[model samples]
Target: MRQRNLSIPRTSVTALVAAMAAVLYLCLAALPVHAAEGFDFYTDSPGIHVTAGDALSFNLHLAGSNAAGSDVALSVASMPEGFTGFFKSGSYEVTKVHASGDGADTIATFQTTVPSDVADGVYEIVLHAASEGGFEDDLILTLTVSGLESGESNFHVEYPDQEGVSGTAFSYSTTIANNTLNTQNYNFSSNAPAGWTVAFSSESTQVSSLEVESGSSKSVTITVTPPEKVEAGDYTVECAATSAKEQLSTALNVKILGTYGLDLSTTDGRLSFDAFANKESSVTLKLTNSGNIALENISLTSSAPAGWEVSFDSSVIDALEPGASKEVVAHVVPGKDSLTGDYVTIMSASCDNQSAQASFRITVKTQTGWGIFALVIIIAVAAGLYGVMKKYGRR
Candidate 1:
């Protein structure tokens, strides 16, 4: 065996070493780099229990990476069939979220709904968050759906159907339940028709919010007042109870019962009349039923000056139908010694639940008998004096 000793130049060796170093640097640069910290995702609730036809919500938090921030888009990658998912921020829905490199965390919310006809079982929901910079993370949430037992719900509202007259206040007894394990503070509100006033009261005191313990319920009274001039019809009111965890609503139907009213006036549409002292005056009054129902046993009454006699032709009426009018005659006799001036006599007509009033003025005049007697006496004295003067002149 022969051995050959081949030696390289210093420049060549130095050049080769530099080239190898460059190649190593390039290979290392081509490899993926791992950072000390990166985008992280977490949620407060990883497992939730709900009933069919119910909704579940949770919050998701995202911590930014130390090196750079990213705009992450969130979505539900997979879920059970007939399940609907929503991502929201305060009151608006959002799909993409932005985080800064300043070490601050961003929060997003997730909501899922289970269909009413779904079977009771455990379902897995996969949530994915992908960044524009190629950073991706996935989280798994477990959902357990069960059939709703009797009188069991996350929240509920109970009310009775009601009927009331227009312009009247209607109250409903409503029961609210809290079926969760934690005590909840719920805010009470209502959506009513225009020109209506609605309020909620607990234990006779008006309240805007109330606290209910876990697995307990409270009864609240909801009062709905229609406008003064509302027409007779059917109306609806929607009442809601809201909290951070849940929102519930119920509708109440109300049928308005028409009101009863009456209008009383003279036949000439006049509310006042004139009369003479010591004489009989006749007046005609008409009663108009302005209500929706018929009125029975209509009666007439009056409050007149002292020593005045007032009589009605028909003191009691048999029946008065709605949108109909009936006339009655009144005979008013002023006192013999009634003074001359204006005097008022109030007449009222009432039937069932309705009543109306009218007034009349009486002007008493001096009797003509005294004036005629004085004139006759003056004429007799004048004639007698003239005869006496003539006889004395002739003597």
Candidate 2:
């Protein structure tokens, strides 16, 4: 049972994570602004909860002594997803977009619309008003939607492999499945991992949900391009299926497969060298396959600073059995007139777009010119004192 490298595959894993994020935005409902300035505004019911794509009207009363009938300018500052702020006559009504308002109150009223594909949770709507008598008011109204309607759509995320990946870009595929009877139109969405892009068939594009027939299914493929600097890790995201009839949602979990691409000189994974100008040193690389799946066509590449050079004996490997291990070597050298102190370079191993890098350091030392002059001055002084002592002995 050799220790397997725990690097994730870059391209495949990234794509999957991006898809999950897109779906998450649609399932989790954004809460409306819940802070307001009014007569010590408080909700008698604590909060109102609702599901994605559902609509409701709530009656909130403004109770204050000597504050009634004073022209209060009611304004809604914020609202949750799929909701708009407006006013009817006096009562607060939450409806879909394009729904009519009932004009009833002399003072301004606030209304909103609830989107059909939002998630279940509590949302906030902030209300504010001011009076001529120097009285001001604010309120935090709670809106909660629970559970899913149509309940037939689900989303699942898949990463490339969990062990490790070498490249910067990962490819992910998302399957948006419709489990209900009626044909549904859906919007495919995701939030990609940091430094990554989500592309569908047309380069990480957005897509509408497929119209699935009863007992049938459809899926969309999304490609994720992660930044070249991302490391391996576990990431989760939410995905949703949206249509005019109703919305459905599911969670996606992804694991990029492969070992982190860098290799090591010592078992503790440290690079080693001594100060030497115009000399080269040898370092060993112990490559590990951290991914669940085997890797193929592995190769090494390098980058160095001025006056420093690097090369590798083995640039490519054929196959890495899952959980297997192998080794390679890298050479570092400084030019004849290279400066001293510390010189650094980076070596990357890439398979397709997946890659990883190892940092290299070199030290230089020179014992010429000024160094030789100092040594000669010290020797001459010592010789002169020896000559004077010899003259005294002869006398």
Candidate 3:
């Protein structure tokens, strides 16, 4: 009696099934297209160690499932005692990396070095990669270091050399490691060439000294600028990081390709001169090779108004040594019956890959022509007056 037709009608059952199917479809559609929204931090070589003086780097990979990129902050959650480490993106030290959130992997280099005095041991390290979107990932690293190396310096550098023309600035990125058990205040200095200047900066701020805690490292940028008249050569800049009872020194090399500069001006640096209409004028122009390199086949040219004549005594120079000057007399003739006003003349001197220009302002004076007209009028009036005097005297 209790089992009498307990099932629903066929239509009702079909409707219920359709409703359930619709609900399932809606749930799937509401989900994100890329639901794998998380970060994975890993490395190909997580366990590596070197001698205390040397260092090792880990190629870390941080992947995000979101199609849009993300910014991930990286940190060393647990570092072994007496160990120094830093993170780098290319040659620059970095605290974060941009994760390629398109399900692709972003790479970072994690560099670590133990103190030169640490004991031989195997240690465990923890690194964390977290993003602002509350997604995070952790990585475990293992290191097996041998006994510490004695009498080793705690200084490292990315690039300690540069090449450029003379009078250019040479920059280097250096890292100072404090591996001792105490914090250190390290003063900075450089013994560069004469008439050269050295500067140090950390985090974009200039600093003469830097402080580092135990088992930590800091990065600094050193810039050396040569003087205006510096010679072309290879020079070594000895940079020093000194603390109480300790000093770390590194030498940086700068190679100058030799500057080649040309300057065209007057003796007094005055570029303006005056010339009368239809009259000839002259200006002594100086062509100086102010660079360290000699200039060859220097060609001098001028741009003036139409029909104007400009001739240089030395239109072309065979060669001019550095720090030497050559005088050229530029004979400028105004155009025939040129307008009485100020005009511009562009004087140019160009050598192989080097050039200079001087702008001269020439004032065309019509007073010279006016003087001749006045003389002609006076002659005519005097002739007329003489003829009239003769004729009237006879009458």
Candidate 4:
């Protein structure tokens, strides 16, 4: 065998090696890129369904990867109008969440509220998470709000008209209903005229706030008191119920009835008078209505000592307006043999609703006939003595 010396070219070898390297580079570039291990975010329920004036809640979980732990800031990017939301961990609010290494999980709860006047439709909300380690993620949440078929409100107030006196307390029974699917705490309040006091109570216990379960009702008593000197008229009271999700108010009409009172006294400001036996005396008596309402069919009467007669000019009055006064002449006569002493008589003025009485003192004096008789007797005695003296002188 002839050993022929055959050698390959260096350029060919170089070109072959270059082609293989190019093919390897292309394969490596085509492979998928792996993300760095940091934080992963997810939720148990992505789509939530609820009714109007309802509250929805879900659990959010953060899973850690092979990288170091980081603090993730959580927030709600967008929500419907008149909607509110918050995040909580255990019993406290969670503004920032922490994720540990070694594939640990951190959980936080998210709560959202739907307003009572929200329309029936599907809404979208965005939940976002960010960290200093160049970690950012967001998830889209779906919220479905439905309305009742009967078109009834979730919260309502029931109250009726009330009536009372001006200087007294007015009370009424009210009912509040929670027709939603969640329990709610309601605050009670009212608006009234100036210088008026209002209060609320439940089951005979005073309360500023109360709690009612879902689809249930609560009985509340509202008491309103007007000012001590308020005028008699028609008034209105507005009572309200406030909660985290809804507010309701109702008006109650109040009718005020007036009070009636009468006062009786002597017109001359003297409770005593002087009279002799078998004599008649005249006195003036005054009657006044001091209350807010008018007095009708007012009658007068009197009580005197034995054998004494009392009479009035007019015994009955048709009507007496408020704060008005009337005067009547009263004629009083003593008995035939009345002794010289003080006498007391009670005069009363009465109306339909009220009455008053006053006492009068009368002092009796001796008759004039007895004085004339005593003077005649004294003159006769003097004439008789003069006659006797003259007769003796002549003898």
Q: Report model 3's TM-score to 2 decimal places.
A: 0.50
Q: Model 4: per-residue lDDT, tens digit, 1-395?
A: 98999898999999999999999999888863323324556686788677787777877776555224677788998888898899888899898877663333445778888887899999988888777687766767898887644423233335466666566788787887787656778898888988999898999999998898878988888888887667778888888888776676778787777756688887778888888777889889989988888899999999988898999999998899999999998899988879999988898888767799999889998988999999999999998989999889788
TM-scores, each model vs. reference: 0.55, 0.39, 0.50, 0.46
The parts of candidate 4 lying over 4 Å away from their true place are 1-48, 51-86, 95-108, 113-142, 147-151, 154-159, 261-287, 295-321, 326-395
lDDT of 2 by residue, 242-313 (tens): 666556655544454434433333445876466566678767777776555566898877787767677878
* Candidate 3 C-alpha lDDT tens digits along 257-347: 7888999998787877788776789999998998878889999999999989999998999999989999999999998788878999999
- Candidates in order have lDDT scores of 0.79, 0.58, 0.82, 0.79
Any runs in candidate 1 off by more than 4 Å, and if so which? 1-159, 368-395
- lDDT, candidate 2, at 231: 53
Candidate 3 residue 177 Cα shift, in angstroms, is: 2.1
Q: Report the candidate with higher lDDT, 1 versus 3.
A: 3
After superposition, the stretches of candidate 2 with alpha carbons farther than 4 Å from their true spots are 1-268, 367-388
Per-residue alpha-carbon lDDT of candidate 1 for residues 108-227, written as tens digits (9 for 90 to 100)? 788888788889899988988777877776778888877645445333345457887677788888888888655678898878889999998899999999899878989888889998
How well does candidate 2 score on lDDT at residue 19? 92
lDDT of 2 at 342: 79
